[model samples]
Structures are given as C-alpha cells and as structure tokens.
Target: MKTNFLFTMLTGLLLFTACSEKPATTYTINGTIPDNSLDGKMIYIYNRDNNNLNIDSTVVTGTTFTFTGKMDTAAYCRIDASREYYVNFILENGTINLDLSKPVSPSGSPLNDEIARFFAAQDSMSDLIDSKRQEFMKQTEDKEERMKLQKDFFQNEWKPAYLAMLDGFFDRNLNNPIGGMALNYMDGYLSTDQIKAKLSLLSEPVRNTPSMQERLQRFDALEKTAEGKPFTDFTIETEDGNKVSLSDYVGKGKYTLVDFWASWCGPCRAETPVLAEVYNQYKNKGLEVLGVAVWDSPENTKKAIEELKITWPQILNAGEKPTKLYGINGIPHIILFGPDGTIIARDLRGDGLKAKVKEVIETK
Candidate 1:
C-alpha cells in the first residue's frame, strides 16, 4: 500500500514540474514616442518570411505603446512605423524598451554599437570614393586611363575594404540585423565571383537561413548564367505586337546583348548613350544589341527611343513577361549571349561591358 502511494506521488510531481516549466520567452515591448502626432500609429515587427507581429497604437492619453509577443529564437526583428521610419533590433527572451524620441536615422539604431560602427565605415568609404572620383576627374583626359583608374580602385582598394568590413561585422555578430542590408548592398555592387568568394566564408548556420539561402541561389544562378550555360528563355510582344523571342535573335551568328531597362528609369537613360556608342562601334564587328523595356508605357517608351535616337531592335509593352523570364528584380540588367544562345556575361556595365564585348569579339 505504501509502494503504491509513493508511485502515485512521484507521477504527480513529474506532471506538475512539466506543466510549471516556463513557456517560450515572450518579449514585452514598450515604445515611448514623445511626439503626440505619432500616437495611434501602427507598428510592425517582421522576420524574413514577411511574417510580422503587429501592434496597434496604444491609448493616446500618454505617448507610450506596448507590444507583447514570443520570438521562436534569437533572431533579427525589424521594427517599422510605416514606410518613413524603421529600426532593427536583435530580439531574444527579454524585455525590449524602445525610446523613439528622435527620428530613426538611415544609419540605423544607436542601441547596437557595432551597427553604428558599420554605418560609419560605410560613410568613410563613400567619402573615399568621392575623393578618388575628384582626383580622377582632375588628372585624366584619356577615357581609357580614367577607366583603368576606376577599375583599379574598385578591384583593389574599395572591394577589399568593403569585403573586410563585411567579414568583420559577421565575426562580431553573425545575427546582426544589419547583415541582411549589407548582403543586399553587396549583391548589387559586387560581381558574382566576388560574392561567391565572400559567401564561402559565412558559417553554415548563417548561410542556411531562408534569406541567405535565397541570396545564395541568386548568386549561383548568376554565376551559371554568366558562364555561357543553358538558361530558360522567353518571348515578349513589342509595342507593335511583334513577338520577339530570345531564340529569334540567336540566329545572327554574333554575340548578343539582352538589355533590360525602362523608359522611366534615370539610370537607364544615362546608360543609353553609352550603349549607343558601343553599339555603333561594334555593329559592323558582329555585335547585336536588343533592348527589353519593362514596366514602361508605350508612349513614354516611344518618346525615349526617339529622344535617344536608338536604332537597335527593341521590345516594349511586355508588361512583366521579360521580368519574370529573367528573374529580374532590379533595372539596368544586361545578359550577354554567345553565338549558340548560351548566356555568357551578366550585369556588365560601363568599361566592364566594353571589355567583355571586346574579349568575345576578339576570340571569334
């Protein structure tokens, strides 16, 4: 009878202990924005999957708001109050107090000191690039010399420092909220080879996150596409309703540049003249250029073509057809195809474009 009682008591104790263990850590957020106008604004905390925790404005009698939620783990959370204001915080199982008395700066949260340092380093680099630009403008009359100088600066000085900063930031805090922003910036500014080299340094955990995995896939696709590999192609209708297939242009037995741009894009406009010059110089040497204008109105596109005096074959009014085909997220994207319809180079700009074209033409 005593043994039975003891067994029952032990089972009850274990059940009670299991039930009493703390629930997953929930962060209680208190935000105090001194300004009365901001009282009733909606705040959101987002993760990589666009999954977000939303908090409605607290009662405006006092300029303070509260939000409570559980984070599955230690991860980066983006705190946003509409499009104008945003701050990123590293959220764990603790109370988070946000004092938004001052406007959130583009430099990001001052609470994370390392993030501040990263921003400062980026600012310094921008200043250095500006100084270099001024120096180059002062000394160079020859276009080739200026191009060489710019290339050298990017490859040797700027790239190395940028990479070092990226490495340092990751080393300090692999889960830094600014890491995503930095990776995005690097994706745009660095070549596939450079990005690949840097990505090899990241820890497996960091590389395996959903966001990082997407970036890795993009980089892989870019590298494969740039190396003259087979890629999916599509057709789009021009303003005149003429179907233009990427395959149709490949029969010319020459290297082709498939350019993605838009009439409304300022960068595309600036690049038009450069492209025209390159096209005129190399047209006789078996180089063909095809422009694909995305998200452009027919009238605006016609005006741009007329203003630019572009004679190359172009396809506009394609809506999102070409964008989806190329997996294009950003504008001024270029993909070069060799004679056999295999993609050769991608995202080439300015002198890099010229150099790649020259190399391909010379080999042929």
Candidate 2:
C-alpha cells in the first residue's frame, strides 16, 4: 500500500510539472560577409508589435553574428546591417541560420522588391528637397518666398512620396512586416493634416484595421488641439502664490496675449524684448500679456523674469501638464485670445505677432 501511494504522488508531481512548463522558443541567425571590414559590425533585430523591445545591433565576430531571444510565435523580424539592409523572416521555434553570402530574401516574397523600390524613391525625394533648398537660398531675396519654397518641398514632394510608399506596401501585402514598420515611421514624422490626407488615400479594408483606427484617432485629437479651440479659460498661479486666470484679466472685455515660453529656451529669450515692447505699448490700450513658462525650475525662471524686466504676470513651474493640456510642444509658442476667451491666432512671433495684435485691436 505504501509503495503504491508513493508511486501515485510521484506521477501527479510529474504531470503538474509537464503541464506548467513552456517550450523555449529562440531564433539563431548567422551571416558571413566577403569584406573583412563587416566583421565586428552590429546587426539589429526588431520586433514589429512591441517597438520598445526593439534590440540594438548584436556584435559581429569574424563576419558572423548570432541573435537569441524568445518570440511568441512565427512573427515578422527585420535584420538591419550597415547599408540599411532589411529582410523579413518567419522566426519559428527552432534555430534559423542566415548566410549573407547566399541570397536569402525576406519571406521569399515579391513585396521585398516593392519595399526596396520605395526606399529608393524616398532617397530620391530627400535629394530633391536638398537641391530645392539650395536653389531657393540663391535665387530668393525675400525670406517669405524662401520659407514658402521650403514648406512646399515638404508638403508636395516629400509627403507625397511617403504616402505613395505606404499605399504601395499595403497594395502588395496588407499584413506585410515592412508595411507595419513603415506605418509607424510615418506616424512619427507626418503632421495631423498630412496624416489625414494620407488616410483618405488608403483602401477601406486597410483603414478599418485596428492599428490604422488607433492612428486615425490620434490624428483627429492632434488636429483638434492644433486648432486651439479648446484652450479657453486659461489660468495659472504666479510665483508669489497669487491665483491668476484669463477670465479675471479679460473680464472687462480686453484682448489677451497668452504667451507660452520658458527661461531655458533661446528663441523665447530673444523674443522677450520684443514682447515687452509690444506689451508696454499696448497695455494701456486694452491689451494684457500673460507668459506661461514651462519645463523650468522656479529659481531660474525668477532670475530670467528679473533680467528681462517682464512686469506682466508670469506663470512658472507648471511642468508639462499644462503644456500638454494646451497641446504646446514647441517653445516660444504664443496664442492670441479674443475678448470673449476664444483663441484667434496661434504661434505668432515677431512681426507676425505684432501684425495680428494690431489687426485685432484696431479692428475692434
């Protein structure tokens, strides 16, 4: 009886252990290059879904490098080298060896060719922008014309090429590994308006995907913030603990210049004298200026305020919370609020700020 009981206990323990254990899943990649210089170079492996887990280059030894990591299943993987070489591979639970000497394409699909073409086009567009910039600087004496040319290069040449690349990738394979990575890259650079324009070009099926849906939502939120329609009732505390709000300043029907800046920002510092002059001139004529300083320590900000002789109510030490609330990412950001607490203009600087302020107050 005792022997039987011991046997039963051992069997149960073994069964539990077997049920709980998970199989080790790893991918091993090895490569050899003809050039001895390729040895000791770094190779990077990127996971498509979790971008934060994107691993850096694995050191190459004798023109060979091996990467070991547990993947959930056979998913998309990108192998990058010195010349920006990319290949998509299905990483199974076993060891997979890759030889650079042998031609091994990503996923053995024609879409890789399409991606390569798109990258070539991207390079071409970058070259075009550089060339246009040089020409604009040489031929144009007007600063406005040069700025317009720069904007057009990005809006027309650069942006259209990027959109074309995305459309081409999706057309080839909706679930392409490279396509997903390209989409993430686009999200980083493109503005809200540019993204919306690109999304309008995508097919219905691609638009309906969960990833695309989330991106669209982000674009919408950003667009709304950029419009500055929601920054009403702007308020902050002064360094002396005095509670100041836009409502109190603009209460008696006065135009307010809600300036967003910081002491550490060089551009903001440069613009301070101009702002002070404008404020001094317009303060008696129903103009109120409020400087909202972000991302600065209180002591440093106080010193700057004294040095710049800023007499207006300055809000210091709001950190990033208020800045994000107002959707302000850049320093030297200025917003013109009408008497009714509605945002009339945004990011006005130097002559632009002066022009807008004069136009609004004079018209009123």
Q: lDDT per model, in order?
A: 0.65, 0.63
Candidate maximizing lDDT:
1
Per-residue lDDT over 1-364 for candidate 1, one digit per residue giving the tens place of the 0 to 100 score: 1323323433321221112445446766666665567566655666642334442233333567776666554455566654544565555444665655433222212223344455556666677678887788888988889889877876777766666565555544544345555665677667667776766665565566666676666665555555557656777766566777777776458888877888989888887877887888899998899988888887888899999898898877767766655656678888788877788887878888888888988778
What would the per-residue lDDT of candidate 2 be over residues 275-295, giving only the tens digit for each residue? Answer: 888898888888999887889
Query: What global local distance difference test value does model 1 have?
Result: 0.65
- Weakest 10 consecutive residues of candidate 1 by summed lDDT: 10-19
Give me candidate 1's TM-score against the actual structure.
Answer: 0.68
Name the lDDT value of residue 219 in candidate 1: 60
What local lDDT score does residue 289 receive in model 1, on the 0 to 100 scale? 95
Number of backbone clashes in candidate 1: 0
